[model samples]
Every structure is written in C-alpha cells, then in structure tokens.
Target: YAASKGAAQGLAAGIQAGKGVAIKSLEKLGVKYFWTGMSSEILKMNHYKEVANLTDVIYTAKLKVCDELTYDNFVNMCEQFDIKIGVYTEEVKNALLPKYAVPNALNRIVSEAETTAKEVFEAESTRIAAEITEQQTAVINATYSSWQIAITASVIAIVVIVLIMVIIYLILRYRRKKKMKKKLQYIKLLEE
Candidate 1:
C-alpha cells in the first residue's frame, strides 16, 4: 500500500511538472487550449452496453404500457416479445408462431392480458409486478455481493494457508537445529 501511494505521488509530481512546462510552452507559442479524451463514442459505447440493453427493455415496456411499468412488466415483455427478446423476434415468430394462423401480434396482446390501451395494466398485476421487481433487484444485488464476499474469503484463505506453511517451515527448522545441537553435544562428550 505504501509503495502504491509512493508511486501515485511520484506520478502526480511528474504530471504537475509536465503541466507547468506545457503552460510555459503554450504561452511562448501564444496558444492556450486543451483537448480531452472524452468522445461521443466513448460516452455512448463504453460502460453502457449493459445499461443500453436494459434501457431497450424499459423502453419497449413503456410503449406497451400507458401507465407506469414495473420490473415484472419488463419480465413479461421479454416473455411476450420474440419468445426471448432476440434481435430477430418478429422474423422468427412470424415464421413459426404466426404460421399457426394466429398472428404473433394477437398472441402478444393476449399474453399481455390487455383488450385495449384503456385496459393496459391491471392493479393486481401491478402489485405482483412490483413484488417481482423487488425480488429480482434483491437477487441481482445479492449475486454481486456474494461474489465480492467470496473473493474476500478466498484472499483470506490464501493468506492463512501461506501463514500455516511459513509456521510449519519455522517449526521444522527449529526441530532440526535442536537435533543437530544434541548430536554435537553427544560427540563432544565421547571425545572428552
């Protein structure tokens, strides 16, 4: 930790020195500007793919629902749309389920339990949806937390194993030294 801190401090100092030199050079050149590494692609693409997929689910749910949608709405949406919300849900369902003489759109509507936009979401279904959402959130959070705890436990276990090995090595070394001492003493006594 100390070494890491020292390295960070050294880097900070180097950056500060570079900044001062850069400022002087810019002043001499009669220029003053800086460009940042943040681009639209970086902001849009990086660290957002997971959130992006989630957003698509949420957006689709929004279009299907006139009222507020719950987490269960998203879950139901996944089940209703494309058999599993695939990139080719419409195409696949159109080829398969639509062949049943029942349109895929009608099946989705029936599955969604809505006769019309006025009957969009049920109160009971909403309550159940909220509960399901809460449970799903808990599960995802628990999974991530469990993994972190497991990693921590693994690190502790490794440290303890190393400590045990070092302790065993020290004990063996001490015993060997005592045995050598006793052997030397017996040889000296015989010589005497």
Candidate 2:
C-alpha cells in the first residue's frame, strides 16, 4: 500500500476538502495516527502514551468492575487508571499457594509471577492439545474417505489406489513419530 501510494503520488488526492481521510473508517478499526512534520519530537511526547495504551489492554490489574468500557478504555488504563476486569479478578480473597504465607513484598511478587506462569502454561497446553486433536480428526476422516473409494469400479481403481496410498503414508508418518517419541529413540532404533 505504501509503495503504491509513493509511486502513484500524482494520482493521490491531496489532504484537502474531499481528499482527507474520514474519521468513521479509522474509528471502526480503532486506529490513530498523529503525523507531524517534526516526527521525532512528536514521538518523544506520544511514545509513553502508546506504551501505556498497549499495557492497559494486556494487563487486567488496571481495570475496574461495572465501568462501561469500549476502545478508549484501554487508553485510560495505561495512564495509571483503574480498570473493570481488575475489580472482577481481584474479588477472590485468597486460596492455596502456601508461599503466600510469606510476609515479604518480594514473596508477593514471586506469588504473582508463579500464578501468571501457571496460567500461561495452561493456556499453551490447551492450544497445543486442541491443534493436535483437530489434525488427528482430519487424518482419520481422510483415511475413512480413502477406504470408501475401494467400492468404486475398475475405471476409478487407480484414483482409489492413490488415495489409499496417500492415507497409508500419512498414518505411517504419524505412527513413526509416536514410535520415535515412545519406544525407538529411548533405546532401540527400527527401520520401516
């Protein structure tokens, strides 16, 4: 898009009455561009706001409960304001994690870090498991489809054979990986 604009500058409309961008489209995507001739100085002042805006969206600690929020809510949070989700998630007084008994401030930080780490690990595990399950189902469905091809007449026999061969290759590749992971790589190595 940038290259197209640069090379076709003559075809481009100047920033004027009908040539300027409409706020509606920009608002829909939640985009903001504060372009200035002195970009370096402009960024020096606005960069902190940009970081705060991003951090507010990613972190729940800045949120509050029952605070009607939309896109700009993120910008508000980054400037050290309270966020709605912060109130919701903070309602749980206390529970397990025996290390929470420590009275030191550093211990509290460690506890929070451990909690965040556990959440991250669980999320990753769930994502990977879901991906594996989806791929496994696809492979199984493809194999089933290939098996159905066996009923076709000799005219379609070659295509069915190719389909079956492909299915067999996929199944063997999956099994080979499992074998390497479980039995072969540990001690014994075997050939196909």
Largest lDDT belongs to which candidate? 1
Estimate candidate 2's alpha-carbon lDDT, on a 0 to 1 scale.
Answer: 0.38
Instruction: Give stretches of model 2 more than 4 Å off.
Output: 1-103, 152-192
TM-score of each: 0.29, 0.27
lDDT by residue (62-130, candidate 1, tens digit) is: 345523445775545433544432323444444443233223332342233222211222333444556
The lDDT for every candidate, in the order shown, is 0.44, 0.38
- Alpha carbon lDDT at 174, candidate 2: 100
User: Which TM-score value belongs to model 2?
Assistant: 0.27
Tens digits of per-residue lDDT for model 2, 1-192: 333433233122211111112222222222232111222332343221122233332222223321434457555433322112122123443432212221222233334434443454455555555666677789899998887765566549778899999999999999999987887565655553
